[model samples]
Target chain A: MRLKHLLASVAMSATVLAATGAKAVEIEYWQYVFETRVKAMDQLIQKFQAANPDIKVKQTTFPYADYQTKVAASIMAGQGPDVVQLFYGWTDNFISGKMIQPLRASAFPAADIERDFFPIVSAMKRGNDYYGLPTAVRSLALFYNKKIFKDAGLDPANPPKTLDEFVAAAEKTAKRDGGGNLTQAGVTMDMTGQDHQWWREVLIRQNGGQPYTDNDSKVAYNDEAGLKALTFYIDLQKTKKVGQVGFMDEGQAAFRGGLAAMTIDGTFRLGSFNTIKAFEWGVTELPANAKGERSNYASYFANAITTKAQGEKLAAAEKFLAYISSPEAMKVWLEVVGELPARRAAALTPENLANPIYGPFLKGLEYAHTTEFKDEMAQRQVAIDMVNRVLIGGETPKDSLAKAATAEQAILDRAAKR
Target chain B: MSATGTEAAAGGLWSRLSLSQKQVLWAWAFLAVPVLFYTVIRFWPTVQAFYLSATDWNVMRPASYVGFENYRRLWSDPLFWQVFRNTFAYLLLGTPISLLLSFVVAYYLDRVRFMHSFIRALYFLPFLTTAAAMAWVWRWFYQPVPIGVINDILATFGLPQQPFLRSTTQALPAVLAPAIWAGLGFQIIIFLAGLRAIPSTYYEAARIDGLSEGAILRKITIPLLKPTLVFLVVFSSIGFLRIFDQVYNINSNDPGGPLNSTKPLVLMIYQTAFSSYEMGYAAAQTVVLFLILLVISLVQLRIMRDR
Candidate 1:
């Protein structure tokens, strides 16, 4: 009876081993994406699973609002995912702490990937350590309502070339249907989310102001350029009334309402409004200021490997990252989801050049610059709130700038302690 | 039994140990598990929060003791004061409006309603719908544009669209209107139960005296419902004090947008902690807010006692 029981236990152990061996390897990915990118991500995951036959990808998606919290909290817990979606700004936060594992030359080699992307993509790298790879390149462009411009006796073919004209045209196009209330707005320069800081950043940058100092010593938001940008926005709300209501989200209701002639927003919002039929719209470059400088805002997501993941799992993750970032994959992503290609090679391809969806943004890219992308994650929250205070809270330019500086200093101190 | 024998029997009760006593000890052993869990999960965190408030700590770094510096910052900060003012204003407006509206509707519905339970459930719909979704729906409804419901209504009335939630002067009041709406259903049900609990003889006595319906309601019903009214006032004040999501969702971190008009204290606390990453200062703001609410509640209770 004892011999029979031992044999039965051995058989059960063998069955358990077989079950464990058949289970698929799990890979975790995190992102701040929604809609088409989310769907495309599922498709990409399915495709990779079929190709590998052993790896199973698990995705944790949050809206952009929660993504920051999730990343910081997880990283702090020392238990982040096997692979993660990173914005260029977060590179310093993770990499400088040696929290992220860097890839060697063989695992993408830098050269095989370096020549493909814009200079901004390399901004995530520090020395010889490559912390991330570009997933998508997003930049701001001027989207104009063609129908509104024609009604305002402005040439739809020729948008404003200078900041002065842009302001004048914005004011001229604004009209009151009754009782000094705006029936149609001339411009939408700001909002609360993703690109709220774009136009302001561009104008500030052009006026020889930096959101942060050159060495990142302190917030330089109170500089001349910052004041000028703030004054212009205040004038739009207070004097011109060309911008709809106060506070951009409430104010810019004119754009989506088909009343605003032009809006400076990221190219990503184009997909959200691709099927608008009430008004004919077109894209163009942001107008230059008197200093002959112009820029649209830029920000993007990247693919990064984790420190904890090992061996075959790491290899599979890298392959999946590379495949999604490939020229062909970039084409598929852009065609279906309306995302800009992270790779310059993909963006400059014949198919992409001829695509009508990308026309204005492509025109605008020559003058594009990044919004305040920070290395230390601590600075991000303060800077973001600072923008909120200025663009939404309606704090005076000086006060807002001072708040940003104070907040930024606190963040820096916290980061130093970390 | 003799008297001495009875006295000996009474003295025998003082003897230690029994089978039932041993069983009771085993039952007490069973209760220890949940008590330990409560200490760890519930009581421990409350105690830890007190200690954390005295220190300068981000999640990653070692917590440095800073004594009462956070509280000191709370005293001097204008943003903290603004949010404090906003929260108080929310309570000041929201409580009375909700209580009055709930009282009226609930009283009318209580007298005669088909499917009483169904009517109560229907009135409680706002409480049932998830807060986040309702806040989003209200966001669009409160918009100050051609698309907003109120603006469309104004257009039909031949009036210009007013800046409802975005105006400095109008934003707080306009935001309060939705909160008042959202709060009505729950308060209504509470009042309905209270009204139903009142003795019918009081109404009958009022009728015998030839009291008018309005007169009996004003004199008896309201005075009788004071306790329920107090309950709603306290709960609603707590709700309005933590006014984060509605304001946060409406403006998307532009909570006090339009010249710092709508930002509440709780929203400021959240922004300071998570957005601005000033946890120490945020904690200070929170401690101040908690004290403010506590003092107000105590004052309210004292005044209520007087009445």
Candidate 2:
């Protein structure tokens, strides 16, 4: 009699909940698979579910290589995830393709976003509407091995503050054998990875030049500033002989193996650096140009709602996004995933601003900007071609940059028409 | 009664048909499933790809007809020409090298009676392994000194470390080495089966006639293995022509790295379609690849066929 009464009460409550328009709704969220990121997302989902009793969040992750393709294909098939996390680099395609819907004004106001998030959020906005909000924003900083500095008779506490000093320090720390093969690289200057970031953001900007124009619909990096930047990077390999581009990971593997002294990489690398026990390393602001002006590149991945979502599903997705972007969730991401928060109230706190490992990256947020382009992959190919022409093809920087500019301009023109 | 009588007369005439006609009808019925399947799945997409080649489709908008514009772009693009050379290089170098190495291994191992099955299984092991896994292991072997096993061996011999996958001139061969190694196992297995199928009487007869071992191999063994040889050559040629996974995996950091010295045609198609979302352009490139593969295979078959 007691068991029968208990079953009857549970069934009655379920029926009443359904009748009152409180039926359970499930929303799927997708992201790229990363160790720390997966754990952090799981924690955030648990917190979100606790707040919304009638909503369920199903999280899926794809490998980094296949994430974009999977999302685009799924959307084309009309079965995409309700909410998806996309890199800011991919924002243009998703928006123009009409794969994602913009946030409703009443739910997420433009003023609130501008005041809360970093300035780089402007890249995610079109006209008067914003597309997405990041939980964390990343910036590049100088990661130097402390022991390499000490061995080279340089001060361990004080890293290079200017490009000239940085080169001098690299010369002292770089080690080559009798035959001049690079056994230990000083810094990674390969265009294969960080060299492009260092050139465009730090060198070009510090040289007092803009990297693009016309709402990022034009390629304007073929001027004097670009020439100087390319010359500076090429000198590291050809003239200064501090590094070469033929290594496994563009000297990243060498740096991690204690064979390289320094590399300019994003804060996402801090998690990987923490696992290294062979060397003592520290992070500092990227070295400035001769004028003492500094700049950095900022990138982020943000949650976006898909066009397939509607009505109840859209409401659930919006609520989930709001919870994930909250200060509480940002703090959890920072603590668990080591990605610095994008929210001003969370990131600008005294405790966060004082941390030695993360402080330099946070400082970079003041002057950093996202590199916007119409077709990022095509432009990246152009950069690679430009650098390879100078480094391996033995072509002059003047000639290569001119040709690359023409090619990039053609792509931009085509993109504009499309 | 009149309709029933007419149907019975037609049924009686059908039952009186010849045995060969019944067999032909039965064969057609059996083949219908696969024919319909291929028309729907394979042939339809191939026809679509040809039509899409002339249009401009980015998977976002409705495909618009653009005439021969995509083909014109492909003709003018320098990367397409370079990739064309790289693709042919793989087919020309990879097929013969893999075939020769497998033939040598199978020839020698056939005569060995000591743990023959075990040796054969060892030779066939790599065939069962995944291409991606094999490529990664080979990538580790091609790394710099103190990490790469090959460079480590060179160091032990007091020789200088050589950059394998990093150098442009050496990268294609370095990538090809693993591809050839992976396919060798399957080819060797097929060769062994072919060798086993040959009766020993021919060899014994050649020996009794006082012919040398070399003469017997050239005169009898080679002639008997022509069919297997032709099959393997064609199969291996197609595999080499479509080489993508090995290059893509070994050079995952940059899909076609060191200035794309090792990029095959398929990898370029993938990048053009997926990375840049130029579906029509990629389709044009795909049609070109199809033509090349078809021509190469037909030419090889014509040359290596019965004559």
Candidate 3:
């Protein structure tokens, strides 16, 4: 009887061992390192792992500066991550290189994804195939210092709504020393950072012009509308004397340090700006042009599956991607990272839409335009040259823009061949 | 019989060789490892780069022969010319100014007996520090009024705050300052060593002859310090010619910016290769840089030689 009991126990233990031997499939995901984003991703992965116990995710984050190099190198070495997050601008390069593969229709229904995500997510698609999907989208908004407005004798609550009011407010807020140099900037007109994005997406569209045309194969910003947009920008320095290029340490530093009154920045800065204690700040929709038509630039960070991933690995990656798009995951991402959710349903919810800080950025997304940039760096360089020629070189806006258009067209032509 | 035959052959081979031939054989035996290493690690890549420069390879795409297309494009490109001028400016200005400043400091500091090692260590501290850290610290020093130490000093003296790194005219000099400063320690240490190597008897003879301080420095001291000067000049010229870290860090916001005034050839090559993924074009630029470095070094060595 004792021998029989021992045999039965042994059989039961063997069954338990056999059950545990069925291993979980693991997939690697890569993202550029940002503290809040990394944390949110980790939390999302935890939720994913708990739900899908048979699937495991291995997450790695690289520094933003070297992220592209690392990803490209790894992909070329045939050791790429199963899932990778890329800037929307880089979609073409990765797609053309075959570093990333398009989502299969059966696995990821194109109709469903388009219905679930923001319209801008379609930028990741080439024809009928979708290359990637975004968890959040960022839109540009006007961030103004309340204290600066109050000191300038303007009402703190009433942010500028139109171009005329913007210039008027900027004039009041601008402070200069005895030497006629800016001590405190009224608004950041410098193209050191997002100024080019502002020029291309906001000003060009506002002035009834398109930045690019012919499926982004040609430059369209050399016309009267382009001239008008550039003149308006240059006039801020030459005519209004509100902001200058070298004023207050360049880019968003002046705004962050409370040395600049206003800056047109993105929703991604909300987390960083929240750390500022020196001044009270508020966000408003981007000011409309004289025609009363408003435009803002929206961009996103998208997650894609690499070409190296196939069969079970691809399936596991798709599962993770799906998890990232789910309302629950996006909610966590928005709360933790301060990015507006990419999904319409998620972003339109009462909690997110009702939040005073996030409301303006979300509202801007309704009419925001995201460019499917062919050569983002080259295009940006052309814009920089245009701004510099007009601002620093004392050239006419029309002449500078014509030169920029020629240069930009050459780049676009080269990209078209590629 | 087989063992005996093998021993006999080995002995015959050794005995037949001349002394010089044996010496050469032993020399080659010792040199073999380093020669193989250079061939694989250095020479091989350099040769491959020459081939790559003539092709269109963007890492992902299969490389196709493009003849001199990349080079041809580079010649017509205005940005390349601007970068070329910027690079040469760094070499011409950085080498001489840094050498003069370092020599002046080393010459004076050599005579001081109080806290000698400590002072030397202080000068050498920057050499020991990483270039990235030094660049960032200097970048802070070049900031506007409240943030920058240099501007704060200017303000203290009731001077107008200057946009050191922001101005196109000033940004290059601002970037070069830290680079020169970082290299001072190594140059000073080398200079001190050279000074110490000169026998005290020459200075004593000069003193007895009633030679003035400037005359002795101009004559005996400087004449004796030629080798050290030559080495430092060549090394520092190479350092300045390949300048990237300081410029990259200082103008981090828009690197080589404020109208690309601070751009060096290496930074341009880096951006082209990595940012644009134009490997073939980048390789062409690399070849140009290499040729420049080689020709300059040869010219420098020829000029500074003890003929």
Candidate 4:
């Protein structure tokens, strides 16, 4: 009787062990903390888990300032996210550093990706294999305060369409105190922000200067067109006296606070701007050059499978990536995060194209150039310093432009060598 | 039986040692944990850093030997030289100015009996506040016309508004102001303690000698406060040399910006390591910083001690 009882108990324990063995595969996901992005990702994770009950995903976040450092350190220590979110510009660094692995062709086919996603999404493609995929993309546009335009005696419905019109409107809208101090900025001028992108890809190209040449391996913005582009930017503050660099400390702050008349910003700013109840704003395409040529800068953050993902974890990560990159997921992301969807079908719908707020940004995508940055921050800093030298140091635009081109070329050369 | 036998054997060994020898053993046994900890935690990493400084490591790939290429590159890098100058400026300007201001405050506060601790606490309040928070507050204070307090005051007085953090020339000093202020409390407290330690008799003797207040301060009080002065100069010098948080938080949009005007050695090291992910180059920078700190501290000690 005792032997029989023991045998039954042993069988019960084996069944319990087997049950535990077949439990869900848990994988970790990491992203820099942006409120709407985090919320959208959380909602998607739930939807993904409900559909694929055999997999569980744990999401983690760090502040944007420390995100790169945290990822580099944690992944190097052999413990970190199975799947990670990285800026599209950092794809090369991530690929070369072995922080992320290429997607399996069977899981994510290059042909399918090329067909469905925006052509700019090709930035993530390294040779034949794709390193990652973006759920959304961003493009720059002119965000103007309708009330400010009316206050300055300009038509609210008619924002600037050309570079000359932009300057004229800015000069009219600009207000100054009795002592010559600027009371109201005609437009925001912050080089450390999106202005760097505006100057490099938009203004330079509009003026017939290619920011980079030879497949983005060399700087090519040191010519007369580049000088003209830079001079025009500096003249807004120096000759025109329509704006100041450090008026309200930041361009976005000044715009949101209603201290500035206009700002050039990206699509990612839409959600935050929508929350401001103080003013009614309008979005317009970036001002074109004399020949009616227009340009813009497009950028995005993409989700990638980290090198840490292997075997079961790798399968789980790929599934999560696929789910996040789906059309349905793009819809949810657009509703939550206010960034344009990466897939052409998801982004270019009738309702979306008709949206005045998102329409300008989408229109910008048609002529946008995605700069293949080897080091985004360093290159951005060079542009910032170039403008500051002209603005603060009283250096001529010609000298500053040459200096910037040299500095950026050195950065690219260093990265290439590495 | 074996356990008891082992215990008995250990006891026999312990009993055979002299009293001093037993005490020495006990002391070593007590020190064993910390020494082991330091070896693994501190010394090992420092030694590893030296090794890494000689190699090309970007954290992801396996490190390969690169001789002194990183060091050679750093030597030629103009940013390195500018950063070096900025660091020394922080040390020279920040150390002396803060020490003087703190000394004056502490010297006067020592004689005031009413609300003394409260006044000291008011000064100490800033020290307790986080560097990031203080930097943000100061940043707001330095803003233009309608937003910034300083500029607001200037506008009211009809004085031209100064661009504090924006101008490359003014930015370093603007960043330094809050750093000096934050450290004032601790330095004041130390000075006060040092002043008190000089004893009431010294002041009384100076008074009896018919020395003026200034004379008393110059001849007696300062001389007696020499040791305290030495400690503070060294302490604050090190503090200024390693300054990072103030400069970083002040102009966060461009942390050593407006043309890298206020970038310090530590900030440069952090950027090289984290932003650029050039571990080997960062390690070389780190070694340079370590040597600078070591040499400065040694020179200060030697000068202060000899005098």
Candidate 1: clashing pairs of residues: B256-B263
Question: Ranking by lDDT, best first?
Answer: 4, 3, 2, 1
TM-score of chain B of each: 0.84, 0.91, 0.91, 0.95
Better candidate by TM-score, 1 or 2: 2
RMSD of each: 7.4, 6.0, 6.6, 4.2
Distance from true location, Cα of A290 in model 1, Å = 4.6
Say which candidate scores most in DockQ.
4
- Tell me candidate 3's interface RMSD: 10.4
Worst 10 residues of 2 chain A by lDDT: A244-253
**Candidate 2 local lDDT, B19-68, one digit each (tens):** 99989877997999999999999999999999999988876555899999
- Tens-digit lDDT string for candidate 4 (B126-225): 9999999999999999999779999999998999999899899999999999999999999999999999998899889889989999999999889888
User: Model 2, clash count?
Assistant: 0
Alpha carbon lDDT of residue A227, candidate 3? Answer: 91
Looking at every candidate separately, what fraction of the true A–B Cα contacts under 8 Å does it contain?
0.10, 0.21, 0.21, 0.57
For residues A1-418, what per-residue lDDT tens digits would candidate 4 score against the true structure?
A: 6678889999999999778757989889999998999999999999999999999899999999888878877888888999999998888777777899999999999999999988888788888989899998999999999989998899989999999899998999899988899989899999888999999998989888898987688999999889988988998999899989988999999999998899999997887798889889999999998899999999989999999999999999999999999999999998988889989899889998999998899888878888999888788889889998888898989999999989999999998887
Against the native complex, each candidate's DockQ, computed on alpha carbons, is: 0.16, 0.23, 0.22, 0.45
lDDT for every model? 0.71, 0.86, 0.87, 0.91
Q: Give the TM-score of candidate 4.
A: 0.93
Assess candidate 3 and give its TM-score to the true structure: 0.89
Residue pairs with colliding backbones in model 4 are: none
Q: Which has the greatest TM-score?
A: 4
Task: Put the candidates in TM-score order, highest first.
Answer: 4, 3, 2, 1
Please give, for residues B122-219, the per-residue lDDT of candidate 3 as tens digits: 99999988898888888878776556788778776778888777677888888998899899999999999999999999999999999999999999
